[model samples]
Target: MAELVRRAGLPVSAEEAFAWHERPGAVERLLPPSAGIQVAQCSGTIRDGDRVKLQVSFGGVKVPWVLEYYGYEPGRRFCERQIEGVFARWSHERRFEPDGPDACFLEDRIDFQMPGLWPIRSWAERRILRGLEKTLRYRHDTVAADLAEHARWRDRPRLRIAVTGSSGLIGSALVPFLTTGGHSVQRLVRGRSGEHEGHVVWDPETGQLQADRLQPLDAVIHLAGENLAAGRWTAERKERIRASRVEATRRLCQSLARLLRPPRVLVVASAIGYYGDRGDELLDETSRPGRGFLADLCRDWEAASRPARSAGIRVVVARFGLVLSPRGGSLAKMLTPFRFGLGGRLGGGGQFWSWISLDDVLGALLHAIMTDELEGPVNFVAPEPVTNAQFTRTLARVLRRPAVLPVPAWALRIALGEMAREMVLPSARVVPRKLEQTGYPFRHRKLEWPLRHLLGRQTPE
Candidate 1:
């Protein structure tokens, strides 16, 4: 059998830190996205007798693993024993001890042995153990960061929040963050055929919503919209994009405004598209909107939420930048080619790509919802905006691949049509001026940190 132990000191009490792990979404949060660990089924939340079944992917092949909780000392320790899995034996323990009035020591230990012959078993064990190191390190960092972020807002009352686009990249992450941090989440999905509009609570097609059902909520984060880069932007596809954001948001806001006791705050997702191609100008919330289709769509989309703003709700228009994550979006699409050293800049490589980590996107969203100082057109981006060429090089460096090829602007325009011109190939040097001024602690400020984190790559010398 092999044994491993890791330890860390947290700014929060042992009880407080332990409570974080026991929360609803804590387990999922700890499962690093890059590791490809998915919870198949869960019976309870880290309690004795609770069982969890997981499918851990190994080079696209999923291996089933099952574990049952055993030792459960409240605010102190818990243990999980492998019932059926890849290993011959597996046992994991989480130990937390108080250091001082406001500090805690955390210890994680694992014992396991591979179930095969000597040489093969040793090789597999070595590889798995290395992965375990990275996974645990990520968990520790995430726990510390989350605890700090939550502690800052501990004084604020836990909120009951509703989220649209809960399945989308940002919304999916945001939900887990909110739930684990003690906020209640109510997912507002699109309406289905034959289902009553009131039951669904949102059907932007005909502007129908169950206004009465939204009462007594503390916040609403509206993130529903069509994918801009899902395909070439034909005239029809462009209209779909416009209607999804502009029309749906307008209708959703109208419904929220009609609620008897509407949520105190509403966050509507916009994009850096609000400030179209502004080659090298550094922009902030104070910057004016740019010209073109995306800019116009963004302008109308934000305006569509007028009913909620006019009805006394504190409205936060979040203009998101290029969100970096390995799970989905543009980054996911680029990974394969980049890994093969086929990755290159999209256009002239001079266009700015104001990017933010998926982690920071979640952080900024939570900050926006909690901070009263942030209301209108908050830029959710990193401090530094990298040009397309810079991003290409950085990604290549992270992947240990050389990026020498470049996709010409003309080729992109020929292939993607108007989308190449506006969405994909525009330059917007957007900075999170408002977020910084309001003290929104960014988890990542540079291009490399998040790329490395999301990709599970090691930090360089």
Candidate 2:
């Protein structure tokens, strides 16, 4: 058996630090994006007999691994052992030790063995150890950073929030995050068909919602909208996009405005696409909207929230950049081609791409929720924005693949039409001025670190 251990200091009580791990989305948040692994099913808690099944795909091969929780200590220690997986044996113990009154140390110990020939086993063990080192290090940094962020609101009272788009990617992640942070999450669903605990049915299209259900909400995070990248920008597709964002938002805001005790804050989702096709122009919240279908859509979309703002509720329109994650979004689509060494720069590769890690996006949203001073437009992006070529080269480097081919602008225009021009090739050097001014610290400021963490890529010490 091989044993490995790692430790990190967190600025929170041992109990609080451990509780963060026990939360619903902790595992998903900790799992490295580029690792080609995903939680297929989970019992949703870290208790004895609870199980988590993970699927790992690499080079076209899919492997399923199952872990069963055994040791269960509320705040000090817990253990999980492999019930079914690739290894001959695998067990991991996590311990939280009090370092100080307001701080704690988190430790991870792993014991594992390979089920192969002796010679091959030795080599495999070394590789596994290296991989574990990277993975655990990432987990440590992520948890520590998250705990630190949470520390800022340590004394704040828990809030009850109503969130739309609860099933979408950001919403799914955000709901668990809020719940884990001691907030009550009430999901606003479109229909009563899928109703469950904490779900309130509403119809955005008809502007119908049970006003009583939304009473006493501290905030409302609106994320429901038709996906802009679902298809080519046909006239019909554009209409769906516009209606989904503009009309839905207008209706939701109108309803919220009429509430006797409306939520103190309304965080509506917008896109950096608002500043459309500006070549090399540095954009902040104050930057004027550009021209194009997306820009026009964003203008109307953001305008839809005026009712709630006019009603004295603080409205924050989060203009998001390219959100990077392995599970979905633009990054996921590019991973396969890059891994196959067919990755290349798109449309001259000079367009500046303002990007943000999925975690950072969530952080910015939470910050917006907590910080009253953050009103109007806030750019949810990392401090450093990279050009398309720089992003491509960095990704390829992390994947250890060649990225030499450059897709011509004409080819992209031919293939994807307006989308290729406006969405893919447009330049938006956006900066998170408001978030920074409000003292929101980004967990992932650069592309390389996040890319390495997600992909399980090793960096030389």
Candidate 3:
């Protein structure tokens, strides 16, 4: 096998560098956009025993490859080997070494053999090495720049913002936005068993959070909770869901109350599901929560944060609508079906769907952080709400596919049980009056505009 080694440096801790390397589904993120990389399956931590299946673009052709992580050590090094497909033999090792107090040295060594005879293999190896170098250099520069940015502002006079679920969908996007705008963030990671040093560990079951870790902060944005629609809401699943939000929030708020220097603001995420099945009602911030598992969970979730509010924290409950992104979430799941001409309307298609682009979701979060006047409940949704039919049509149009079929509510109910009724059939025609009242303009006010941008369409003047 031909071997190649490259070294670079970043201005972040060995831990931070390792964290970046170990982010879930990172293979797709690292691959060049031109590569048209689609992750089939990726599991386990990137630091160890990870497996990934990907459809990678080679020139104009797409090739599938399965990669296996053979070895790894946090803040130090990791290695990957191709288990199946494409290359005759492939292996890569990534090393992160501390260079100084705020600098890290990164090195990557790769050995690979292409599927070809000697002369052809040699030529392909040369070309692939060049491409890999260019790509790796870009990645190194990108990471180093990010490290430099964090370093430049890490010590700035700013709010010591601590957030749970800091590596999740909402947190991932919002962290960068917060950092760029001069805020320091600490992740409140859930540790094994009980508590970890320097981390605000919490037991959602017992409603116990490490309150001592919270002190003297400008803001705290709580986005932690179990995903609502991940699985069937069995008795056990329902308990877990309720406990995840209510108990977690209760612990966080209680902890905030104990803080000598409590945060100025506590931005908490709720859901429009609070207004369950609001058929045509133009629900706003003042709308009372409806009856249901999700609605009750949201109500209790918001109520649990009262301790912080009582302690003079500006608690803002942001009720999020459907969040759309090309990268992940519900939209990403639909992309494949829509791309292959299988998209269709759900239920009678009359149920209004209030949605927001992921970028705007982050923007609204940032706005709430910056705007002191934005206290209490705020609806985080697009100005333009559409019916399920409209959403399907728009998506299909964007994908250049046909949306002729209509999924009956009965069928969905039979398949997904109560989940279908709650997640799909219910109509939440929410309006962001509070957000608009504060003059927080939406980056993507309408679905069509953002859809075009996401689908790689250039706007015409």
Candidate 4:
């Protein structure tokens, strides 16, 4: 038998640390991205007889592994043993021990055996151990960072938050995150309202939301907008983008401002495109708006929130950078090409791209909600900004693919029209000055970490 043990220090009590694992998305969050593994099915919790099925792909082969939970103990320990999987025998245990009033030590111990036909057991054991170390390290770091983030508002009361674009990528992640942290989430849908407890219907074009339904909310996060990269930006498409953001924001803020009990905070989504094509210039919250349609639209979009601020609401404009996630955004679009080794830099690759992980975006939003001192424009980006060339090279390196080709500026302009020139080629070296000052710890601060995680690229031990 081969045994492996790993431990991590968490800044939360044993109970809290265990509770974090019980929350929805905890499993997904904990799974290392580079493993090429996804949860196929799961039932029950950490309790006895609970089963988890996972699908793992390596090279061209796919395999399914299932494990059964036993020896369950809340806030203490749990054990899972392989019922059907790659290993001939496998058992894993997770233990949480209280270190102090607000801290705990999380321990993971695993024992396994290779298949009987495998001749080189020792070699396989070493490989598995190395992989486990990398995976567990990621899991522990995520847990610690997430716990530390929420610890800032431990004394604050639970809040009811109304969120637009709740069905979108960021919104979907944010709702569960908020609910897991003991806050109530109300989703503002566009069409017919569901029988769900927290669904509210609204029409952005008409500036209409059930005013009576909003009285209970302490915060509103606006994320609904037309996807700019969905297609070529025709004149009509450009108009739609403007209307969706600028008009929709204006309408939403106006409706919220007239509420009998307006929410304390209004968190709206903007983009770094507000800075326009400023070459290599560094930008922050206080930077002047650059010229061009996107920049102008973002400026107008931000201005539309004035009504809410005038009504004594603390409005926060989150100027988001490229949000990296495998599920959606630019990264999703690039995955297929990059995986097949068809990816390369765009337009000389010198344009700087400010980016933040989807996880960090969620964290920043929560930070905006909980942090009263944060108002106005906050650049939601990771500390390190990389040029297009560097980004492509890193992505290529993570995928273990060559990135020798370069897509020229003229070709992009021909293909995507104005969008290629504006969104694709523009350089904005944005910094999260406000977020830094406020001490918002980014979970995936660097580029490679997130890329590896999102792409399931295993790290060297």
Query: How many residue pairs clash in all the candidates, one count each?
Result: 0, 3, 1, 3
In candidate 2, position 299 carries an lDDT of 90
* Per-prediction TM-score to the true structure, in the order listed: 0.95, 0.92, 0.68, 0.85
Worst 10 residues of 2 by lDDT: 190-199
- Kindly list the per-residue Cα lDDT of model 4 for residues 1-461, writing each as its tens digit: 89999999999999998887766556666776557787887763668998889888878688999999888889898899998888989999999999988899999999999875556887888898888877887788777877887777889998899999987879977876676676778889887676655789889999989766554789999999999889999999999999999999999999998888899999999999999998898899999999898899899999999999999999999999999988788888877888889999999899999999988998899999988999999999999999999999999999999887788999999999989888989999999999999989888878998888666567645
- Tens digit of lDDT per residue, candidate 2, span 203-229? 988989877665488999999999888
lDDT of 1 by residue, 193-236 (tens): 23522123578777777555554789999999999889988789
lDDT of 3 at 362: 68
Residue lDDT tens for model 3, 229-251: 68788899988888888888888
Better of 2 and 3 by lDDT: 2
Residue pairs in collision within model 4: 33-456, 34-456, 34-457
TM-score of 4: 0.85
Q: Once model 1 is optimally superposed onto the true structure by TM-score, how far is the C-alpha of residue 336 displaced, in angstroms?
A: 0.9
TM-score of candidate 3 to 2 decimals: 0.68
Clashes of 3: 1
lDDT agreement with native, every candidate = 0.88, 0.88, 0.77, 0.87
